[model samples]
Target chain A: MLNIKNLKVSVENKLILNDLNLKINPGEVHAIMGPNGSGKSTLANVLSGKKGYEIQGEILFDELNINDISVEERAQKGIFLAFQYPVEIPGVNTNVFLRTSLNSIRKSKGEKELDTLTFLKLIKEKAKELGIDEKFLSRQLNVGFSGGEKKKNEILQMKLLQPKLSILDETDSGLDIDALKIVADGVNSYKKKDNAFLIITHYQRLLDYIKPDFIHVLSKGKIVKTGSAELALELEKSGYKNL
Target chain B: MKNQNLNINQEYKYGFTTDIESIKAPKGLSEESIKFISNIKKEPSWMLDWRLKAFKRLKTLKEPNWQKPKYPKIDYQDLYYYSAPKSSSNKPKSLDEIDPKIIETYKKLGIPLVEQQRLNGIAVDAVFDSVSVATTFKEELTKKGIIFCSISEAIQKHPELVKKYIGSVIPLSDHYFATLNSAVFTDGSFVYIPPNTRCPMELSTYFRINASETGQFERTLIIADKGSYVSYLEGCTAPMRDENQLHAANVELIALDDAEIKYSTVQNWYPGDKDGVGGIYNFVTKRGICKGKNSKISWTQVETGSAITWKYPSCILQGDNSVGEFYSIAITNNHQKADTGTKMIHLGKNTKSKIISKGISAGFADNTYRGLVDINEKATNSRNYTQCDSLLMGNKCGAHTVPYIKNKNSTSTIEHEATTTKINEEQLYYCNQRGLDQEEAVSLIVNGFCKEVLQQLPMEFAVEAQKLVAISLEGSVG
Candidate 1:
């Protein structure tokens, strides 16, 4: 349900994503493995419609061009990007943000809004499943949250939003093994036949739990190779130098 | 949730006047006018003498020019010194006896003085025009040996207390407004909590200016004796008029050893029409003194209305281990101009102070957050943290921050931070993408902007203030 055709993007007049191309269909998980400067996170940001980007190519979501949509509109269109570095908003509680985002998406879909009690129940259940402490819901979003906790919060938002397309940008970074498993499990539990994911990572470890239907090697903002899940193992055995 | 069902044709809900005609001096400020006011109030000879001295100072004291927005020089002589609606033929013995129009005005304002006493368990000293109309729950407070009444009544009942503490912190010559207020001030609330006595209820003063040309100059003094505690609330509103009204008032608080005083003000004076033609020029001077050791004082204000507002409720922390705090949320909409903040002076050892101010400027309005925190040499180990945040709604409006910090003690720690930002487009887009309108998104973001200060208000006032913030920003977005 996502397509990119020779997408060339630049930020602040500096070319970040050169001629990049990728595609993913529903019910499929795609992983993009790249070195530090391969423009992996930049690609994720451009897809989420973050401001200050110069794009020369087309990006399509469900057959609609989405390069001009706002961040929130992208969210309503069922496109979620878990940030590598979460933004900290003091005095804005996590639960409030999640509920607001969920209700916002629901409203855009012409769905009924959930009352406070119902929203609380849903959040409580999802938070527990994600092993998120109840107190974290009342604290300001990402304020003073540890690295792992912020990543887990991103997953929690994804589960509650239940977006059709999820883009994870190095969600496993800074997380311990246990936190990595919890975060992966949260993403795994939200997987559905009608939804898709574009997971970006530097290591092959996350692929152990979240198996990818297709693997693409990205270098210098271009996809150099495309293969099956086994291609992740090959990359792990030999670094990008051998590619 | 009392909704104000306003009649479409009503000039303004609080615009109604009492039939009890007031004895007013001719509009103008002269030595004669000052003397007329003091004589009309039947002040003590010494007080009249004090008024004369203040009149002299008023002449020499130039009108402050540093505040935002410029206006014609105040035609002191052209403004009525005192104006009150004629009193009821028979003074209202209770809430029911008061004028129905007056009661309705309070109801529309959500103060429901009588209902608040019966349902919400709050005591209200409702001041209409220049006179104290009714003070509810006085008997219960008197039983606790607390003196809560009009300043006029206090002078007669508790002369010693009023005589000793009035103008102790804010002298008559402290500022031009203070001098003006000192000379013509007619009536305001006076509270004296005796030593070791905790006030039984939250004392509130609601000042409403009803007369057309009458300028409201009321003075409030609250004294919390040793080991005593009291929380006082001040609120004001005026009738909408084409001619701008002047409201210059003085408030003084004194906290003795181990005493604590909490003062809150929600000033919603008629802010004129959207074009800012005629609204109350609210220039007030309010300060508190921590006299004895361990005394604490806090000033919390939500200033949402006024054509031009220049007020700074401050505190002087004198005694050892004393504390002072100022929390405020000032919103300026349309053509309103507000330059308000606070001053905290720490004089004793281990004293602490905090100032949190939020200014929201919308339309063509200008809002400024100005504050000062000074730590004296004797105030070792003193600490202060000040955070001032301003939000601009449109490009036409302005938000400015001016903070002055003076620390003389080596052991003191003072941190001041300020940030000015326009409402985030991303945040708004995010909210709208979810289906909420732009106004709702702006309200949510603005509410979050002032959340730190709003949380400091009493629960009931917090909700009201939050709603006011949204309403004030209603037409701000394009």
Candidate 2:
């Protein structure tokens, strides 16, 4: 469902990522593990079409080149990136933002949008699944939410969008045990045969819940080694020195 | 790159002129010019005397240079004091007899003058150039003992009421532009709500400056009697002109004992071309006085046009326990200059006032909020709260806030808060990633910034005001 070959990214005269290649087919969950400054976040940002980057080479998703597509266009074409740090947009209600985002994608797909009542019901059921019961949908988007709550909100957006390829960028970094469990449950329920997931993280705690078919260690903007789920646990015990 | 992103390219939408014959007063402002305006209105001798007295007082006053917005040399002698459509020479007794071309002009401007097609429960008095052409729902208003008509007609038909309150709130020697308006004012609306009665419908007036080489001086006076309540709204839009036109208007509102008066205005005069060559110079003076105990007065305005604007709608809280409030949203884009705010002078014991102002400056425009809160010595236990916020877009624009506070009585409290923020690229990127284009993203952010002031506007106008806020800040996102 997603492929990247010879991806090079730079920002403001500084080269961050160089000669990166990866491939993930349908129904596959791939984990990209890397240390700090290893181009993990840069790859996520480049995939989401964040500006201020000097990019070169091919970034194909679903057999379509996404290097030149705008951020919203990529999202409309079933590509979603859950940010490590969600931007706080005050005065925009959470529910309103989610509804607009989903409806925009639905409209591009030639599907009818849910009205106010239907949207409210859908959002409530989704929130109930995420264990968010306290009227957080009406508040401004991530204005003053706690760390765990913000991560849960990201998962909520991913569930609603139902993207073909979802990039979870450090989704388990700031979460507690309860929040981590709920997030894993939410992701596990949404996993299907025609969809794929790219989990970017540094720890093996998240790997215990959502198992990946293959794990790749990213070092100096290139994959140094590829293995199975045991690779994550081994890296957790012995660190990156052996890789 | 930033300059290209911040260049606003929206052309003036209401720039066409209607070809209508106009009866114009001779150029210049002298005793004779004032007399010419009064004679054209066919006023009584006392009204003529009032204008001559105002003109005599105006000679001693100089053009006010105290405002922040700069004004070029105004050629008073070259300005025509009065110009009305020639079709209304006989004063068209009915709306049907009025010129269809004039009605069509208003229809094109999005203001329906015909009562049946109008926004139900609201009346409109349209002023074309310098004279009031038609006032809708006149019969319905009069049946409730509410007198709403042209100020000129009030002088001829209801002389006693007009004479009693003509200069009651704002005297002839109030200021420079007000003195000019009092001397040569042509037409405006006059409203009087009877004692112990609430006005049934929302009263409104639409002012248009169509004729060129003319000055529009409107004088509106509203009086809410004892135990009465009234909500009045006024909206103005002007056609494009090559030379700058002067609009010096005077509005006075009086609330008696146990009465409440709400005055709202949405002003959209032409703001010149992108380079600021031709537009309106809006110098207006609006004041309301609470004369009796327990009376209230409120002023809400959204000003989005004019090359230079200098206005301060104020309230004098004279009666004990009286309250005053002011909410304003002002936007200046592409060389437009606006210096607007309000004043609350507390002269009564236990009186309270609150003010909220939002100013947005984009392009090379300059926007300032200058407000005054004065608590008199005898105003024991009085209170006032003021909040002024300015939002700037792009590096070329500017926003400033200057607040004056005075509390003579030891027991009184005056609190003031001011903040200035720029529309950063971070906010825009966040919105853009959410599937909104630059224009829609800027509009959404600006609307959120001005939500406090927009909430104070009436429902019908709130929608239009939100759209105006978006359209005004079109390319200010560098």
Candidate 3:
């Protein structure tokens, strides 16, 4: 339930994404694979409503144009972007941040907010499923976390927020094999008929875990090729040069 | 997205001036003004003489200019030194007799001046302008042998304690502002805890400056007797004025043998406007001494307001095995200027001290941390640890750290650490992407940075201080 038409993005007058178009329906998974300098990450950033970018064209979620929405509003409207590198916010406890984020979205959606005890109970169950220590939630947010832990934490947030449209921007880059499987399992279990995912990556390894319904190759800021799950394995063998 | 509305009234919520008739002393800083103050308070001859002595020294003490901020010379002859609400001419013997308007003013400020509406366990002394209008839970405090009263009342009733402890820590000729405060100081809180006793409740003083062109000079004294313990809190606010106002206060604390004194301050004076045209010039002197063996003293402050803030809450470790600690969080935004820190002096053997300071600068403000640690020759085996951290929101603001450490004994050890960091844009974006606005994100990150210092405050004050930290940084982000 997401649509992008002729989306052109630039920063500091340098074009990053050029004439990009994509669409994802409910219950579907789409993968965009590209080589270095291809606009895969740019597409993710543009969709999340980041500032300081010169953007053109339109992006629609559920037939509602969201190009003019703020970042927080976009998040409240069920748009989630998993960053390539999570930030280390010292002094902010992970649990508190999670609660604040959850309650803010809940308030915007006119839903009942969870109290501390209720939130703790829900978070504990989710953390256990993802193999996260309870102690990490009490510490500073991602201050000294390892690479794998950060990716796991990202997935935990994804599961917690339960956003309708999840954009995974290089989520599998720093994860080990076990961690990658845990992330894939977390996403696979949450995949519902009303939710969609846009997976952006460089390798075919992650696709082996969570198969995509369709795959598109992005080259020099445009989509150059489209195929099914087989395209990822083919590109991994032949590389983008022969695409 | 909905249009974000910026409410200007919420910026300085305490900027409303109370409209009331006031009786003011003749404008000027002279022997006559000091005498007028002493006469109105009806002080004893000895107390008047003490004030006169401080006035004599103030004449020769030129205002110090070593601070980072430089302001226009204050015209002492053109400013009123004392202004009190006319309704307080005859002190109220009961809460019912107090002026209704004065009580209403305190009510609007969220202070419970009446006994029926008291804040559960904390005893408050509400000082309006130059006079203390009401002190809550006085009789209850007296039941536990805790002497909590206005300094004016202390001079008349408990002269012995006042005469002995007054100027004992800071002295009359300490410096420019302290000396001036000693000379014409009209009213503040005084507290005393008897030996072998822990105070039953927190003692707090709320100072409000409601008169225009009148300098607020308050003197606070607190003493913890042998083996006794006490905690005191002080808060200040003023109306938004177009002309700069002066607030020079002196606070002294003494801890006797095995005694401990914890003092905390939440200074939220008016910081002028965004253009920095007017605000309070808060120059204060606060010092505590660990006088007897094994005594301890600690200072905690959250400074968020004032056009220019210049204060150093210090401690002198004079007893063997005594300890001293300073925890401070100073925030300057929207053209505000602050130069604050603490000093720890070790004079006894095995004395120890620790300091933690966090300074946040936003808009075009400037924040500085100036601290000193001195270990005397006799203080063998003494140790000191210090940490200073600064956070800046934008490139237009500035933060500075200046630390001076001196150790005369070879056996003493001193450790110091300092860091300066700009607010991480990525962190803000992360929080924003998770559903928080820019302001909320900034507040979350800032509160985390000041967590160490905010923890030192009492539970009730800690919550308020956290909110104040957020409000101080409102509209700071671009």
Worst 10 residues of 3 chain A by lDDT: A44-53
Instruction: Tell me what TM-score chain B of candidate 1 gets against the true chain B.
Output: 0.93
Q: Rate the local accuracy (lDDT) of all candidates.
A: 0.83, 0.87, 0.92
| lDDT value for model 2 | 0.87
Q: For model 1, what is the alpha-carbon lDDT of residue A176? A: 93
* lDDT (10s digit) by residue, model 3, range B177-268: 99999999999999999999999888899999999999999989999999999989988889999999999999999999999999999999
> What is candidate 1's lDDT per residue for A32-145, written digit by digit as tens?
998999899888888887667899989999999887776666777888888787766566667777776788778878899888799999999999999999999999877799
Q: What is the TM-score of chain A in candidate 2?
A: 0.97
Candidate 2: clashing residue pairs, number: 0
User: Could you give candidate 1's per-residue lDDT for residues B154-234 as a string of tens digits?
Assistant: 776777887798878889788888988888887899998999998876788899988778888898999999999998887
- Residue-by-residue lDDT tens digits, candidate 3, A1-243: 899999989989899889988999999999999999898988888788877888899899999999998888889899999888999988889999999899888988999999999999999999998888899899889989998888888889999999999999999997899999998998898899999999999889999999899999999999999999999988988999986
Per-residue lDDT, model 1, residue A56, is 91
Which parts of model 3 are misplaced by more than 4 Å?
B1-10
- Model 3 pairs in collision: none
Worst 10 residues of 3 chain B by lDDT: B1-10
TM-score of each model, paired residue for residue: 0.83, 0.93, 0.97
Off by over 4 Å in 2: A95-131, A192-195, B1-8
